[model samples]
Target: MSEARKLLVLVGSPRRDGNTAMLAEGVQRGAAASGTQATLRFADDYITDFLRDCRTCRRSDGECAISDRFRTLFLEDFLPADGVVFCTPIYWYGMSGQTKTFFDRTFCYYAGSYPQSEEVLEAMCRKRIGLVLASEETYPGAALGIIHQIQEFSRYTHSEFVGTVGGIGNRRGEVAHDPRDPMRGAERLGREMFTRHYADYRADTPRSTGVWCG
Candidate 1:
């Protein structure tokens, strides 16, 4: 039997028991059912400060010394994951501040000139996949805008843009009422992608290019 895939799920919602979490939980359930080894990382659990724009990551070493919880997660977990699921709630027509800061802190992993280290690039190019989960009430348009940001992140970071799940009009576990909710879709997307590209996964999907798992 093939070894199970290592999956990393990042939850970016401030509300631990909100709709976003509910959707994330569904995705987690689907992944677990597929026999994939999954890890859940919550951004709210870790207190992080704003990233001071000092351009410290621009040096040849390309490392950030902001001294926060982000540093610990990067060194210990995120960098080694086979795939990533990004779950966040839309706020102010964009992703939550917590999620945004997480992206900002990724600077600590690379060099200043943005020279893509082979390992980082490989992580992006190889088994990397992105899943976005967002929630909105009447104004789901904002959620669409936020998803663009996630797509941009995928392109820039060399991660594969698998797909996105937008849960609208449903608060709490209302999304669960819909059998075909985005959360379930997100989980299935992860499993399908892993299955299709199990052995010879390609990361040469190119950066700054638009690709969707639709």
Candidate 2:
């Protein structure tokens, strides 16, 4: 039989058992049921420092000067994954600091600073990207900024933007009681993570007009 697809889930929340973590767990379960090997990693555990000035800290070999676990997490866990899911609690109406820092460090690869820049870019293009967010507000646009950011990231990397799941909650474990049932959506997204392709409904539907649901 063919090898199982690998999924890397980066949890950006500091709270190990918070609302965001719960949603991530649901996604993992769904991915597992679909025969995917899911690896859940906490950003707080591996990432300690933010991306620094590349001019002063970058190495000749294209590695970041700041020493941390992020390098290994990126080169080994992230680059090898067939699908990647970013799980973060919406902080100040955007992705958490950990998640933002993780993306910031990828600048080296995109800047062609790496020796294997071409290969790294190629690998990124072949993967599928997903997002999971938990927030205190259920407002319509609370998570829009993050969603747009992830969409743009996928576009820039030439990867498929699978989808996103947003949960509403303030206290720990409150997401489980959300009426919107974001956990279920998270699971569904995970199950289809490997096979789903994003499409603009407005473009696909000929009769569509200027109405924006989101």
Candidate 3:
């Protein structure tokens, strides 16, 4: 028997049953149909309070210092997952502060203070595939910027950027209500993930070598 693949979906919206959640649900449906384990995690459950910019983890065990509810996510759930899906609603032309903060805190692991070899970071990246699903009712640039952020994340971490699905002109379950919109795209993305073993193709080098879109 083959091992079951695992995909982690992170919902960055504070509201439950929102557009982001709906998209994540679609992705989960696809993953399950393909025989993969799809895990959904909501940021509302992970974030307790606003992050106050404590970089202590950089100085210590390469772990975030403000350690509260999110620590387990950073240490356990995130690192071990075979793939990652970030679903965030556009806020102020970018990702929600909650999602941004979560990515920012990961700087602890990248600071290289734990004496772990670059090989370790490379392995972490190679083992993961990242997906971003964002939506906004207005300017599509916001969603584009969020995707760019994910691309940059993959580049620096040497991870795989599997692509993103953005739904424009939608708000508060608008996409969810429409059956032909995001859910269809999200499910297709999930199906694609199941067919490919992302970890095998991901490398420490960018796909275009500094030309962006890693």
Top of the candidates by TM-score? 2
Evaluated at residue 162, the lDDT of candidate 2 is 86
lDDT of 2 by residue, 135-159 (tens): 9997979899999999898878777
Please estimate how well model 2 matches the true structure, expressed as its whole-model Cα lDDT. Answer: 0.87
Instruction: Give TM-scores for every candidate, taking all chains together and pairing residue i with residue i.
Output: 0.75, 0.89, 0.77
Better of 1 and 3 by TM-score: 3
Model 3: ten consecutive residues of lowest lDDT: 53-62
Better of 2 and 3 by TM-score: 2
Lowest lDDT 10-mer window, candidate 1?
A: 192-201
In model 1, which runs have C-alpha deviations exceeding 4 angstroms?
54-63, 113-125, 138-140, 178-180, 196-214
Cα lDDT of candidate 3 equals 0.69
53, model 3: CA deviation in Å? Answer: 5.8
TM-score of model number 2: 0.89
TM-score result, candidate 3: 0.77
lDDT (10s digit) by residue, model 1, range 119-209: 6555554446655655546565767777777667767766666666777635676656655566667667656645643222468744444
Ranked by lDDT from best down, the candidates are 2, 3, 1
